[model samples]
Target: MNITILYFARIKEVVNYSSEQVSLPDEVETIIALKSWLSNRGETWQKLFSGSGVVRAAINHELVDDMATFDEGDEVAFFPPVTGG
Candidate 1:
């Protein structure tokens, strides 16, 4: 399935990309699975996305948890948690 992936804030900086379109492997069915799949890209990906809570995720603009399910054409975003000044 094809989906759009968005990286925001420092996550963007670390990934060196703001957005990308990718075809999800069949094994990747949920947010956590997707993170694990991407984290295989390299140490950079692993550090940024290998575990829970390090970054926040959203699907179609609504924030979601690790277990959240996404499908074809969905927009998935990742960003660090926002903090007050």
Candidate 2:
């Protein structure tokens, strides 16, 4: 399946990319799996999605958690936790 992945804030900076289209293997059906798949890209991806950081996710513009399931053409976004002063 093909999906559009987006990065925001520090996540974007760390990844050095704002967005891209990803083609997932059939086994990657959930957000958690997608994260793991992306993490395999390299050290930078591993660091960004290491689960130690406060990463937030959204699917198709609606905030979602790791268990969220997505299909082809879905828009998935990852970002750091929002903060305000």
Q: What's the number of clashes in each of the models?
A: 0, 0
Q: Can you give the TM-score per candidate against the true fold?
A: 0.91, 0.93
lDDT of 1 at 17: 98
Candidate 1, after superposition: displacement of residue 48 in Å?
0.7
Please list the residue runs of candidate 2 whose C-alpha ends up more than 4 Å from where it truly belongs after superposition.
Answer: none
Mind giving the per-residue lDDT tens digits that candidate 2 earns over 1-85?
9999999989999999999998899999898999899989999998878858978999999999999999999999999888878
* Pairs of residues at least 3 apart in sequence or in different chains that clash in candidate 2: none
TM-score (C-alpha, index-matched) for candidate 1: 0.91
lDDT of 1 by residue, 1-85 (tens): 8999999998999999999999988878799999999988998999887645479999999999999999999999999997769
Q: Backbone clash tally for model 1? A: 0
Q: Clashing residue pairs, candidate 1?
A: none
lDDT, candidate 2, equals 0.92
Model 2: which ten-residue window has the lowest total lDDT? Answer: 46-55
Worst 10 residues of 1 by lDDT: 47-56
After superposition, candidate 1 runs with Cα above 4 Å error: 51-53
